[model samples]
Target: MKKLINKLLVNHSLIYKLFLYIATIILVVYLFPKGGQFKYEFQKGKPWQYENYYAPFDFAIQKTETEIENEKQQITQNSKHFFEYNEEIVERVKNEVTQKSTEVFQNSELSQEEKLDLNTRIATILATIYQYGYIEASSESKIEKAAITLRKGNKIEEIQPYKLFTSSQILNFLNSKIGTQPYTEVQNQLLNILYDAIKPNVSFDEVFTQKTLEENLNKISYTKGLVSENERIILKGDIVEGENLRVLNSIKNEFESQIWSKSNYNWIVFGYTILVALAFLMLFLFLRKYRLDIFENNNKVTFIFFNIILIVLLITIIVKYDAQYVYVAPIVILPLVLKAFFDARLGLFSHVLTVLLLGFIVPNSFEFIFLQIIAGIVTILTISELYKRANLFISVLQITFVYFIAYFAFSIIQEGNASNLNWEKFLYFALNGAATLFVLPLIYIFERLFGLISDESLKELSNTNSKLLRELAEKAPGTFQHSLQVANLAEASANEIHANAMLVRTGALYHDIGKMDNPMYFTENQSTNVNPHNELTPRDSAHIIINHIIKGVELAKKHHLPDRIIDFIRTHHGTSLVYYFYKKEEEYTGEDVDESYFQYPGPIPFSKETAILMMCDAVEAASKSIKEPTAQAFDALVEKIVNKQMEDGQFMNADITFKELQIIKKVLKKKLKNIYHLRIEYPE
Candidate 1:
């Protein structure tokens, strides 16, 4: 079981990578829109590309949106208003008026007969006012022909609430009934009392009104008519307007909703799976062909796929609900992030594949693809230095501008006019651009998560003010100066060979940090003639020398340096034999020596940057021993030193070409001559 576990652990990269691809394929295939692709790609006002479309089955001719809206409005306008009767309000007002009338008659200076007549008249007027229902005043003078279930006393009577009277109508009725002149004071008092008592006893019932309106509207059949099977719906080049467009749209909707057999749906799923699988396959091939290092590193490949899946999943959700704002998803961030860690080519390729997959879900797939592809290209072009704060801002502006222009152009081509451009979409474009600026922090987070080093981190590490490098300089000044020269040589060669110069330079800066452990034991830091290694045996000295790689690795981890920089410490020696100590031991003891004791425990330099560092370290350290730094001597010394390391097979495992090594040798010779002030000969 332990052996099995070890085997699995050794080959975990292959296992997880396979799992990632399978999982991605499953996720995309499942999340993809299940409906079959609409066969025809016809747009409104554009000439049809296909032959005449015939009705597949006898289906209803549904109404257009405009027609449906108009019908709904008519139903609402014609629907009767509902009102509920409140007898309590009417009775309360009537009793109060009667009490007031009694008080008035009691305090009157009129005769008893006249008081009786005034009381009777007041009673009659109250009855009449209560008989007619009043409504809350509205802005429009609409006559509400309403029915009500009257709640009079304990008896509930189903009757008309009586013809509804507006405020003006009620005032006119009162004026006519209470005639002018003969008993002006009594009439005026009676009219004033009635007006004050007239509150709206009938209230609108919104719930019942809405329910009735919906029920009536539902009764209006949406299906106006049906078309026979095999009927020619519309001809090629025929304008689909008015009733023809409605029928065609109804056919489309019905066609979409029709359920197929389970087996047929399986076929649709299979087809969608093929398309999605192809998209991911393209990405895998791209990485395999052009970026094999990233392809081999499971973490890097995972980050790329994660970004792709995240973008696709977000777009899927957006299209599932509101597709109008799909453009606001910041899909361009995929390219920007990929470019940050890797290069522009990989970033743009991943982004294009992701956008194409999303194109299957978004509405107007053509326009969406066009807009997103253009934005992605712009992102790749404009975003050169991601670590620079201003570059990201400017790149985002360029991406947004590209989206704006592309969308505007596509809209013009489709709509044939700038007048109908969707000005609101520009807001979504700007929002997407602003959101893309968030990729900077995202790059940092991914760098931490995957144990990957980005250029931004490289720049920070290259600073001499950093705690680890500063300590190295302070404790061992000679070693620190040697590291600086090595960094310059490595960076120049890296640039010439099209490798990462910043990465190599950063690695070179911290490569010999372990030498700070026993500064005097190393020659560069040994200021006096007294040697620490002289008192120690050759084996002990070799052991100390070989352990610097180990100690350097420990210090780097303590200071929280990244793994990429730590690799330089691990591989700078590249398993080369420490010939000085081994030869010294052979001469003194005159016995067989174990080569392993004098060799570095190395997993060698596996990348070009690390390989370049190995060469630079050897060249710079050997140059310090050169007695006269002349041009011919410099050339011979560089060739001899580098050739010895090459013969020892130190660079075999490193992914450095012979030509790149040649370039490194040239760079080292020129840099050393410059350092030693070796002047060129001027012939007469």
Candidate 2:
């Protein structure tokens, strides 16, 4: 069990990576829409490029969305309205009138016979109002309906609303009923009484009417016709329009709908899993072959996979809700963000792979994949110097424009006319462009979450007035100035070698922070030329010199600087000896000494940028030591120092080549000559 545990513990990072890949693949596969792909691709007005196709089985020719929408609209226009004639309300109102009649007419100066006549008139009007039906017409949605269905008890009748005495017309109808005679006070009183007593018996039954409307709509067939088995769908080179388009769409529906069978479902998912895994596998291989540092760093690898999954999950949810908005997913943000954190090549590669995986789910796989990959390419190529806000905004705007142009071209090709292009899709592109601007904040968030660094952070750290740098400057002004010179030299060399110049420059600025703790111990900070080293033994002096590397690392951590910047402090001297102190000790003792005491403990530089810092740091510090600063002397100094470091194999771990080293050497030599006011020598 112990041996097994040990074995399992070994290659922990490799284990984590494998798990991440498998988990990513599984999650992406599950997010995919559960459907089989239609083999043939066709569009309206476009010629069918496939060979002559025939129906494999009989299938209903389903209507297009436009056709379905049109049918639904027609149904809505023609559907009848149903109302329930509430007889109970009419009875209640009539009972109230009857009970109050005696009280109301008691004050009237009328004979008993006249009262009887007035009561009979009231009863007659009540019967008439209920018989014809009075509705609150304003509550009805359709004001000009030709007819409405009235349900009273178990009986149903169709009647015109316009012909009925509506609630709005109650007063006019009552006044007209008291007709033609000059209006008497008693008649006017009775008219007002009737108006108060009459209630709308016919009320719109929204629930029942909607139910009936839904039933009618449901009865409408979605499929207009059927294509028989072995029917030819379309001949090769024939335009897919009219009947041909409908038939092809019917077959596609049949194929997609048939994916419900367990066998087919499993098989389809299996195929999807394979394709998704392959895309991720290609990404892994790319990282391993080209970006081994990122490949080895599990956090960065997880960060990449997290972005891919996040994008997929976002688009999947959007597609599940409404596939029409899938294009608005801001797919270009992936490339933009990755490029900010990593490099352009990695960013573009990851974007293409992610887009390809999305192709499995988004509608119009070819078009979506093509547009996203193009936009991603645009993102990687056009966007640079992401520390600048204007650059990101401008690049995003250009990316949006590319999306529009490509989509318009595709639409024109498919429809064979620009006039038929859908304008709504342009809104989606605009939204996609807008969403891409969120990459700025997202990069910052990822930077914090993954403990990663980006150009923006580098720029912020490169400021000379930052807290840590300021402390270094005030405590050891000479070392701070030395750091600035080294920073400039490293930056120039890095630009020449096509490495990350900003990262190296920032790293160079903070490399000497350890010298701040013991300012007088370093030669640069020794203002009075007080020989402190002369009072101490050679070994103790060497210990103090070698101790700076260790102290720098601690100071960097205390300052919460990014590991990338701290790397310069750690590896600037590598494992090379403090030769001046070591040689002095050896000359005094004249005996063998433990060489380790004179050396800075190091992992050395492990990347091109770090390697460039190492070279620049050594060259800059050594260049200041030259009393007779001549062009040839500087040249020889650069060559001899760089050659010795190379002989010591300090850069063996770094991912830099001899050609790049030579270029960096030339840059440093020219910079050193320019610094000392010596003219650069030209080849004769």
Candidate 3:
């Protein structure tokens, strides 16, 4: 049992854990009953109780009656002091007339005869009415008929008035016939015009009847009663008691009968557990291939334990708070933090697996899961290469913008209330963004505890570490100076090629560290002293120089530098033969010597940066031995060496395309030219 427990605990694949978690959450959600207290009254032995509970016909009628009564009162007040001069009404009528007349006249496409005919006809009608003195009489007849129609039982629709007199024509006639006056000509004329305008269509008997008022009042009262009844029903019964106890009890009983008692919850829980377990297993398998370090450090086991605890805590929080769905924003920070500390591929895998797991746990639709994944991916990608805290903050702000856009899009698609933009939503989004900012510190701590080093940490290490430098200074000062020069050249070259400058410099610092074992064997350390290699054969001399690569690897492994620094120590030479010694052997033997012995045992340059370092180291060292170096000589020599290396295919694996190599050659030529400028010989 203990062994089984240990095996399960050590499983690192996120899929396995995800499946387990999903299964557990499914069990919990399935077993747990949904809904809170019911919000309606329960009637015993009533077949139509539910219908009655929602019915609001009486309330609707009451509201309708109240509205009609208000309308009637407004109309009565408006009609008081009939025929009185209303400046607003008269101005409105004049504006309408002027607007209509201008519109008709501005139709220039109409023939002049047509335009004149229309105007003349209107004038003729007005003249005839004025001459007959019928305006005053007609206005009185219209007003009286309108008042009588209102008094009758007929509705406003049934008492149609003066359909032939268009609003524009009435306004035009009123303005032209009745000029502006207080009560003498203008007021009386306007009244006569209004009366004549309305008289032809009035239903005098209907308007004068008392029964019309009674009928309107009855309709209004009936509508008010219906509305009141609905309102009362909405607030009917011991609402608090019924909703809290009886209705709630009925819903609970229904759930118990339909789901719990039927063992549907059990089936759901079982299915969920199986699915979750399967998901976790798949995740474990996926991660195991790339993240073997987790297995080596027992992190897999610890992670499983942590996940279990997290799951339990989350479940507790969910149950206690009755949370509809988890706030998935916090999970987005994890992948970013992981990618910053670990390999990007591993971080991406973890991100995808976690999102899938969360999707299962979350109760929302598939869209929510998709949205969460998108947000997480954006957040992670933004900060994946971050080497500074400021970048993380900037990424957080970017993620905040993405989240708002995504949320708003989701709301729009869901047909949610988007117009109700309130402070709460702003505050919620602000708090979520702020929460992401806070995640950085926590991620930092977690990364450190996990023995993970971010790119920033590696950069910091490059600047501060001086153990190799100090060792070189004490044991091989000459080699130290040579290493410094090589570092300068390599760093510049690496920068030119867009390679890692810090790695190049660090690699240069330690590339010749093996010389500390026998400093006298190297020419750089033999200042004002006997040449050690002069006594030895060229083969033996080349052997000592070639052994440094192997010796450096051994020393670096002992010091426990990372694989990248070790790779530099290994590939810096890239199998190029020691030409001087090979030439000397040829001169001595008067024949070609064995080329294999003269060559440094090398796995050819595997990366662009290492290839650059190899070229720079050779160039910088060879330039030092040139006596009275001129710009032309230096440029020729540098070009010759670079071309030889290129011919030898030393840069084949370095990913240096031909175009980049051409640019590199030009840059080197310029640098060498600057270093070896023309100068006049001084008198000795």
Q: Pick by lDDT: which candidate is best?
A: 2
Highest TM-score: which candidate? 2
Ranking by lDDT: 2, 1, 3
| lDDT comparing candidate 2 with the true structure | 0.87
Give Cα-based local distance difference scores for all models. Answer: 0.83, 0.87, 0.59
| Per-residue accuracy of model 1 over 1-684 as CA lDDT, tens digit each | 999999999999889988999999999888887775656655555665679888878999887766788998999887866555577887888887787767766776778987777677666655665674666675123344454444444554555644555566777777766665564676677778878876777656677668989999888777788899999888888765666667767787676667877897999898888888888989989999988989998889998998898898899898888989898899988888887788889988998888888877887777888788888898888877777889889889888888888888777766678998888899999888888878878888988788888888888889999888899999999999999999999999999998888889999999999989888889999889999899999999999988888899999999889888999999998888888999999998999999988999997888898989988999899888889778999899899988988888878877888988898889889988889985669998
What's the lDDT for residue 10 in model 2? 90
Point out the higher-scoring one by lDDT: 2 or 3: 2
Q: Relative to the unseen true structure, what is the C-alpha lDDT of residue 518 in candidate 2, on a scale of 0 to 100? A: 88
Please identify which of the two predictions, 2 or 3, would achieve the higher TM-score against the true structure: 2
Q: Which digits, one per residue and each the tens of the lDDT, describe model 2 over residues 1-684? A: 998888889978999999999999899999997876788877777888989998888999998889889999999888878778887898898888877777767877889998888888787778777885787766556445787778888888988776566766777767767644687777777777777787877777779879988998898888988889998888999999988988888788787667478987898889988999899999999999999999999999999999999999999999889999998889888888888889999999999889888887777888898899999999999988999989989988999999999999999888888998889999999999898888878888998899999999999999999999999999999999999999999999989888999999999999989988788998888889687988999899988888888899999998799999888889988899989988888899998878898888987888999899988988998988899998899899989998998999999999999999999989998998888984669999
lDDT of 2 at 526: 84
TM-score comparison, 1 vs 3, better candidate: 1
Off by over 4 Å in 1: 1-13, 44-47, 60-85, 107-109, 120-227, 234-252, 586-593, 630-637, 673-684
CA shift of 507, model 3, Å:
2.9
